[model samples]
Every structure is written in structure tokens, then in C-alpha cells.
Target: VLFMGITFVADGFGIVATDVPTTKTVVAQVASTVFGPDSLGYFSFQGFTALILFLAANTSFNAFPRLAAILAEDGYMPRHFAFRGDRLAFTLGIVLLGAISAGLVALFQGDTTRLIPLYSVGVFVSFTISQAGMVRHWRAERSAGWRRRAAVNALGAVLTGVVSIVVLLGKAPESLLVAIIIPILVGLMLFIHREYGAQARELEVRPEIVVGPPHRRERVVVPVPALTRAVVQAVNFGRSISDDVICVHVTDDAEAGERLRERFERQMPGVPFVIVESPFRSLVRPFVAYLDVTGTKDPEAITLVVLPEYVPRHWWDRILYNQVTNQLKRALLGRPNTVVSTVPYRRES
Candidate 1:
């Protein structure tokens, strides 16, 4: 009746001369017909629309990250995603969702009709899964009120499952794309789970190994970059961890190596230093080669590869500095039972 009155007012007052009587599909159209364009009411209608849409989006921000954190805890997603920000929000998941939403908006070219069907598929799928899980939970406990809960869950599961299927089958191409994407996501999640399991096995402390304190020295190796505050700090960390610290410097120039050797002797006189002559002029390989030599000599002892890293004042400054640390860490980590440690010294601009 309100819509009809709006149309009547629109036609009578000659506000918007359009043949959109039966088809007031657009919200703005109906709004303009009721309250003339550029009026307070007109702006208020659009404002409320924006507010409601944003509230719906905020729901996604809240829900998806918590779900991702749960998946991470269950070993189905990367542990990094489970980390919360200062505000206790899942920062990675929120950023990931923002990127994904942007990509999706671009993909659909801002067409809501095309977008709605895909959203419906996700919503119903989640609903169905949650209901099914709840049913299982209630059945497992079988406590007081479990029967009622199970019945509710079962009903919800059936309803949502049916709706999910209908939405998926009815919407062609878009729904088909979602179906394809879901399996790929599942495959990725499975891969993550497998990796987490493998890592857990590798890092697990067996009862046999820890039964006795076997005779082994902790050999700390500090890969020497330019002996700045960073290197000094890294060496200090190495000293704290272990008494036997060996500083290895790799250089193509024999003359520069001699200079560094002299400097090491003058500054860090007590600690042992080795000059690795790398004719190939590569940092990581020569360092790894030296580590391999150390490992072969004393197979029982654990080698601690301590690399000094400088965290610059800003993020862009990171590219200018931290390249050597990652490559060396990667190479060092491959050697079994060897722990790679980074001593970060933040550099102020």
C-alpha cells in the first residue's frame, strides 16, 4: 500500500515521470518516487542502505577469522593465521578476506545478482555443516536435554542441506565456479594438515632420547656479516647460549678476509674465528659447506646457526637489508638436528 501511494504521488506530483509502476526493482527508484530526488529522505534511505550493508560485512570480519583460527588450531590451516593482533582480532584472516573480497567484486563487476547466489551457497553450506556437527556432538554426549538438541540439529541440518543443494544446482556457472574452488581449498587444507603432522613428528621429544644426558657439546656458529652492532649483539647472544662459539666469515677477496681476521682478533680476541675462502663469491653455500664440515667432525653435538638480522625502522627498509639471513637460514635448516636461530637488532632511522 505504501509502494502504491508512492507511485501515485510520483505520478500525480510529476516527481519522476517513469513507467516503473509494476517494476520498482531499484531501491533508489522507489525512494525517489516517494521522496523527491536530493531530499533529506532520499539521502537518509541511501545512508541506511550503506549502514546495513557495512553491518553485514562486519559480520564476515568477525565470523571468518574465528573460524580460520579454529581450523588452524585443529591443524587444518597455517599456524600464522591463528595469531591475533593487538586488538585480539585475527589480522591475517581479515587482510586475506579483504583481498579476496576485492578480487571477487572485480570478478563479478559489482553485479549483486551474480554475487548473491554464490554467497547463498557459502551461507547454506556453513549452516548445514554446523547443524550436522551439532547433531554429532549431542549424540556423543547423550546428556540431559541431548535428545531435544539432537532433534533440532538434525532438522536444521536437513533444511540447510536441502537449501544448499538447491542454491548450488539452480545457479549455473557462478555456483559451478564455487564448487570447483571449494575442492581446491579442501586440497590445500589437507596439504597443510599433512605438513603440520609431519612437523609435529619431527619436533616431537621421544622418551628414549631424553632419558639420559648424552655427552654432547652445543657448538654455536655465528655467520659473520659486517661486524656492526648487529654482529656484536648476535655474538653476545651466542656466548650466552654456549661457551664454544665459532665466527665464520666468507669472502672472495683474500685481502679483505685478512683485514676482517685482524679486526676480529683485535675486537673479539678470545673467541675463535675462521676465514672461509669462497672463490665462487657466494655467502650461503660456503657457510653451509663450513657447517657441513663442523657437523661431520662431531656428529653427536648440536650445531646452533645464529644469524644476525637488522630490523629497519620501516617495512620498505627491510628489502635493503634482510636478504642474506633468509637464504642462509634455509640452507642451514636442511642439515639434520641443526637449529637455526636469528638474533634481531632493530635499527632506528
Candidate 2:
């Protein structure tokens, strides 16, 4: 009704729609004409319209994130979308929507004429789907007034569906983008749902399965780079847990490996040392390969890879030492029945 009134007023004023630069300022133009173009009423009306538009723009920010969160909870979207931030808001969804909206605006160069067709198609399609769902609900419930409610919803669905199709056909060149994007989004959601289902099935437990102690035995493997106090501390901790502790070292030079092995044997007597030769001087690969070999030997035993890390006196001093422990931890992650433990040795200030 408001739009119709504006159109009538603009026609009466002899203001040609083509002469108007953009559809967005039509209401302001109408007000300007009514108030002699310079009156306070003209400027005030424009201010009010601007305020309303700003408030209207907030609807997507509120709706999209909540819808995304619900979809995420149902396993049709990424799980991160369902997580609430410190402010109890769906921060990721809000940020994502903002980014996509900004990208679309920039892509179209903020031209309302070009963007409106896409908006209209999306809005009417959603309206049609919602009304159709309501009609289905009314029929399923079949209450005393269901026939009337269903009839009204059915009419709405037909009207909106017609509008959606008409807009798509009329503005195919512009609205085609939305048509293409919708199917891509649907495909992505289906992929997420399938992945979630596969993961759930893999982790599913059966009633026939009897639960017992996790592992039959525990074997600790400490990777030693040098005969430092940190290495000795980790080896001691490994031995305290189980007598089956093996210290490993990856060295390209055999002489250096022998010197470390001698020092390790002398410091921690009776503990076995395994030196892995890495011709390429690669650390993580050779270390992980040695672990895989040991794991293959005793599949039932848990291979606990304990790494020794020296704590820098100052936070900024950490860059001086190589982050071998962090690298090894990342490389060994997700290996079956393999646990990575870190033993931090605090250094003196």
C-alpha cells in the first residue's frame, strides 16, 4: 500500500521514473516535491527513511546466523556455525554473512537496479517455500479450522511461487546468479550431511560389544636429540610409568649418534637406545616411520611418544631453540593407539 501510494504521488507530481537516478531515493524525491524541495519536512522524511532502511538491513544479520546455527546442529552445516562466542552470539555465522554480503555489494558496484532482481527472486522463493510448508502442516494437523488455514496458505504459496517464477524469467540475466548459487549451496549442505553420517556410523557402538580396559600394555618411546637435562627428565618419567621404555634418536651422522647413545647409556643405564638413520636429514618422517614399525610389532600395546621440551626463561627467548617437539607432535597426531606426551623442562632465569 505504501509503495502504491508513493507511485501514485510520483505520477501526480509528473516525476518520471526514468528521470529518477535510483529507485532507493524515490521516497525522498516524493517528499522533496511535496515540501517545496527545501522544507525541513523533506529532509526529515529522508532521515526517517534512512533510519528504517538501516533497521531493515539488520534482519538478515539476525536470521541467517540463527538459521545457520540450526542447520549446523542438524549436521547439514559445519559444526563451528553452532558454537556461540563469548557474547553468546553466533560470531562465525555473523562474520560469514557480513563478508558474503559485502562481497555481493562490491561485485554489483552497489547498483540497486541490478541487485533488486536477485533479491526479489530469493525473497519470493523463500516465501513460497514457507507458505507451502504451512499448507502441509495444516493438512497434517487437520484441526477444525484447518481447511480455511490451508486454503489461505495454499493461495499464498501459489501467488508467491508465480511471482518467483515470473521474476526469474523476466530478469534471467541478473537473477540467474541466485539460481546457480542456490543449487551449489544445497549440494554443499548435502555433502556435509553425508560426511556427518559417515563419521557417526564409524564411531557408533553396538549393544553386543563388551567394554574392558583400554589397552593390554603401555610402551613409552622418548625421542632424544641430545643428552640434555630435559631428555633425562623425559626418560625418567617414561621409565616411571613402564619399564619398557626405548629412547630414539634420528641422526644423519653415525659418530654423533654413537656419542649420544654412549652418553644416554651411561646416564640412564639398562635403558635401550634405538638410533634411526635419516640420510636426507629429515626428522619427523624418520621418527614417525620408526614409530610405525614399533606399533606394527606390538599392535596391542600403546606407543606413548614422549618428547622433551626446554622452557625458555623469557617468552621471547623461545625463538632461539628449534621447535622439534611441536613439529613431532603435529606429525604424529591421529595415529591409531599412539599418544604424544610432552615433558617441559623449566630453565633458570
Error of 1 at 190 (Å): 4.0
After superposing candidate 2 on the true structure, give the runs of residues whose Cα lies further than 4 Å from its correct spot.
19-24, 139-148, 207-210, 236-243, 309-323, 326-330, 333-336, 342-348
lDDT of 2 by residue, 1-349 (tens): 9779989998898765543444536687789888867899988998888888888889889989999999999999999999999999999999999999899999989877788899999999999999999999999999999999999999999999999999999987989998999999999999999999999999999999998876568999999888888888899999998889999999999999998888888878999999999999999999999988878877988889888877677667578764888889889889888889988878665
Error of 1 at 277 (Å): 3.2
The TM-score of candidate 2 is 0.86
What's the residue-level lDDT of 324 in candidate 2? 83
Candidate that would win on lDDT: 2
List model 1 lDDT by residue over 135-179, tens digit each.
999999999999999999999999999998899999977887788
Assess every candidate by TM-score: 0.73, 0.86
| Residue pair clashes in candidate 2 | none
Best by TM-score: 2
Residue 35's lDDT within candidate 1 is: 80
Worst 10 residues of 2 by lDDT: 16-25
User: Which regions in candidate 1 have their CA more than 4 angstroms from the true location?
Assistant: 1-47, 144-152, 201-214, 222-243, 249-273, 280-283, 306-327, 341-349
